[model samples]
Target: MRYETRLYNALGVRLTAEHSLSTGQYEFMWFIGGWDGCGANDLAIAVGATSKGVDCMEAAGW
Candidate 1:
């Protein structure tokens, strides 16, 4: 058997928790579905968040 531990930074954890909310999770999913090959910065602008936050989401495998 194999196992892996997932680690999250403070911001990452916060973002994760926020995304767990019904509205936040829905928005996140909407963004993912609506993504159209835009750059991270562009996506950040479109989503009203920082690029760093987007990076965190990417790291979280969302």
Candidate 2:
């Protein structure tokens, strides 16, 4: 579990440094970018977050 968390955090840092995206934003983009028609609620469920989180992402111009 520790190894997994470390690896995930390392990847998140790399992503943020290279692409200016947090892991959550990357996950959100990965899901929405693949689908044709995905709603905020769908993304929230997919990412295991609340719909309001998705709304915040939208507000940030995600």
Candidate 3:
């Protein structure tokens, strides 16, 4: 658990510093890009987010 937290935080820092993206945005980009026919609900489930949250991400141009 401790190592996982540290690694996650480190990944977040690197993503932000290098790409100017939040972890969620990075995840969304990769997931949506790789998933050719996925809907927002599927993305929400895959990313552990709510459908409403996925809608919000789309609205925000994620």
Candidate 4:
């Protein structure tokens, strides 16, 4: 059997749509959408990500 992959951008990372969110991406989206008063550090911790990730998201038009 063979599997097909779809490439897309999440933040600035080129990722396969078939794969689930990375540890950080999932948390970032969740915190941003579900909570209030979320700061940069808060988002970083929530997503286990860094400023670069944020930059990527921003460039992606988030």
Model 2 lDDT on a 0 to 1 scale: 0.78
**What TM-score, computed on C-alpha atoms, does each candidate reach?**
0.38, 0.63, 0.59, 0.43
Model 2 clashing residue pairs (backbone): none
Q: Residue 59 of candidate 4: its Cα lDDT?
A: 74
lDDT of 2 by residue, 1-62 (tens): 99999999999999889867799788867888899887766655455455766667778667
Off by over 4 Å in 1: 1-22, 44-49
In candidate 2 the C-alpha lDDT for residue 16 amounts to: 87
**Candidate 4 pairs with clashing backbones:** 24-47
Ranking by lDDT: 2, 3, 4, 1
Residue 60 displacement in candidate 4 (angstroms): 0.9
Tens-place lDDT per residue, model 3, 24-51, is 7777678778877877666554554656
What would the per-residue lDDT of candidate 1 be over residues 1-62, giving only the tens digit for each residue? Answer: 12222322444566557764334544655776787775656656455465666566667666
Evaluate model 3: give its TM-score. 0.59
Model 3 misplacement above 4 A = 39-62
Q: Candidate 4, which ten residues in sequence have the lowest lDDT sum?
A: 1-10
- Candidate 2 at 22: error in angstroms? 0.2
Q: Can you give the lDDT of residue 54 in candidate 2?
A: 68
Count of clashes, each model: 0, 0, 0, 1
- Give the worst 10-residue stretch by lDDT in candidate 3: 43-52
Rank candidates, TM-score, best first.
Answer: 2, 3, 4, 1
Better of 2 and 3 by TM-score: 2
